[model samples]
Target: MTLNRRAFIGTGVAAAAALRAPMVWSQGRPRVVVVGGGAGGATVARYLAKDSQGQIDVTLVEPTRHYYTCFFSNLYIGGFRDIASIGHSYGKLAAEYGINVVHDWAVGVDRDAKTVTLAGGAVLPYDRLVLSPGIDFVDGSVPGWDVTVQNKMPHAYKAGSQSELLKAQIEAMPQGGRFAMVAPPNPYRCPPGPYERISMVAHLLTQVNPTAKILLVDPKDKYSKQALFEEGWAKHYPGMVERIGPDFGGDKVEVRADAMEVVIDGTVEKVDVCNVIPGQKAGRICEMAGITDGNWAPVTGYTMQSRIDGTIYVLGDATAQGDMPKSGYSANSQAKVAAMAIRGELLGSSVFPAKFSNTCWSLIAPEDGVKVGAAYEPTDEKIASVSSFVSQTGEDAALRKQTYEESLGWYAGITSDMFG
Candidate 1:
């Protein structure tokens, strides 16, 4: 089937009907409740609705009416794109795909009862549950950093208001104002996100305020694209962006929100703007459900079914997929595999091994983009390495433009795959 954007977005109701009609005509359809409307949940819901053909009832529970993607949020920060461009409405999933999308927060999951409870007191019973609620902050990681403090020093990781807050701060700052970014530790969502954000912000500063400086405080010594990012920063915004790694005393910095100061090795550094991305763990719902031991839920790789509760499948940033960073691309890919597995299981068919792929793009400049990608196959007990690729360094204008084009294509393809 050739799926275009309009057709894809418009098929939500049809997809839902296919799933519903089969069940109504035959024995009962298996109910699948997806908690989250982000990359993982959205993809699974759309695919299940489209492919299940009334054999499965898919209901996606997400609190947001519109989703703002972190994938290209940096473009908004760079003034290259508007926030609306990155925003997506769920109307397609509701009207065309026939997928029931509930705009409410899921409070708890009653695994024994196979029920998901919303904060508004709605109880949704399901034969299978898909949890992809994403990550929450890890408390105590940064001194004096919490939900209250986040308002003052926004992370902007979740996008929306936080993104606007940071952009406003950048715009209001003096020509030489210090813009500090505190990146989180590893195993967090979107590994390349922080670096890309810094690049885009720096790109903006170069045009608006030549003397503006960016201080990157990273806990780890290495990052997603260390060499490439550094090269871009130095070549484009020379002496404007300074990155401090763990080896250079970056990990010792302490954040104080009330005073709006960061202390590095007992030296206080005042900044006009602060973007602090804290350590992350599984979403609160996972904790409330008692499915997670620490920050993430353990899941069977083959089925994405929770180790603690077999009936519940966890995807996206909520589940611990060993070695896989919590990324939107990863979440979307995992969701498809999980959806297929669930379909087979519900149909009393043997589950087959799954393969997954991810391609993450980073825009360094308005026209210059870089990317890293990987394709994987399952091995005994875990998904093993397969193949990976990264954009070659240097000023290849053609390749740079190609990367940008590919990035947009990916957005279209993935969105269509999910909503169509």
Candidate 2:
């Protein structure tokens, strides 16, 4: 099926029954405690609550009152959008959908008790647990860089304050100062994110500090939309960006936050600003729950259910599902499938065959956007891609502008779908 906004909405509806009846619960209403109010968790919570029609008790646990989406964060950095524009609140989810919105951190998960312990010392019990904790950086992933030193060399991967920090640092750069980025390896959240960031940074620098230079040290030999970004950078901001791949010691790199220097191979280059996007793993809570395999949580694509524990489901950037990139769109799509499966198991609702889709849009420059996406289905082994599409090179200006506008519409639509 072609998965668009309307098609996505259709996935959230359950097949009609001639005589609808609420399932009887032994211990009050069936409880679903969703940790992380993101694309996955929020969408799942909303769908479960809305589709179940008051049969399932849904609670969302998120520490922050306002969620800043990482998807459009690059635009914020590039001055295309304000921070408030990307920030969403759970008010509608609570007021309209009757969801229990708890602003607290989920500190621990007890698999045996099927309970989640919050940092504020409250324990939440649940018949079903949904984990969509986006991502956390791997410790020592980049030498001399950690959360303590993030103020010196910001990652800005989580959006919000970090994005503000990076943008401010860029704007404050000397006319001809150098800015550097230590891009993450494969299997990172938003495969095209770091590159899009480069494009956005270039866009920012060209207007304010035209002479400034960007040094991108990437471990990967190739990146998402490589040709498109390269073409845009060349066409829009020529002589402003340089890239170092693994052949030139990009893989073997380190950062010195105090000195504001990047050590590529044996060479140390001082930079005005450094954005260090380190290797990533599933949110720490998955490990705490003993549901993670190595750096990620493994789940069945059919229901987004944990391979380790069926009672739990993992979504979004946290899952080790195959084929699908770790993206907000991917998580939102998966949430609907998981929500349907959970409802079916709990309320005997009709569950359709799981269909997943994701499209990643990157703004190359002003009105220059490129995208790649695919439709997916659950096989016995994994979520396999059946078909795909991408923005091609040499596209006319009109089409590129249209792609950028399409992304804006998608951002508005998906955030509404997730929060409302």
Against the true structure, what is every candidate's RMSD? 3.9, 1.9
Per residue, candidate 2 scores C-alpha lDDT tens digits across 1-420 of 223465555543356322145578789899999999999999999989888888899999999999999999999999899999999999999999999999999999999999999999999999999999999999998888999999999999998999999999999999999999999988899999999999999999989999999999999999999999999999999999999999999999999899999999989999999999999999999999999988999999999999999999999999999999999999999999998888888887777888898989999999998999999999989999999999999999999988888887788778888987
- The candidate that achieves the highest TM-score relative to the unseen native structure: 2
Which segments of model 2 are wrong by more than 4 Å?
A: 1-22
Per-model TM-score versus the true fold: 0.92, 0.97
The CA lDDT of each predicted structure is 0.81, 0.92
Q: Give the TM-score of candidate 1.
A: 0.92
Q: How much is 31 displaced in model 2, in angstroms?
A: 0.3
List model 1 lDDT by residue over 1-420, tens digit each: 233445423422212211211223243677899998888999999878776765678899999998888777888999988989888888888887789899999998888888999999999999889999888999877776887877789989898888888898898889799999989997788899999999989988988888989999999979998888888888788898988888877888888887889887667889888899999999899998898978889887776888888888899888876656678878887887788778766755334457677778898887788888787766545555588988877858888878887777677766666655
TM-score of 2: 0.97
Would you give me the overall lDDT of model 2?
Answer: 0.92
Residues forming the 10-long window of minimal summed lDDT in candidate 1? 12-21
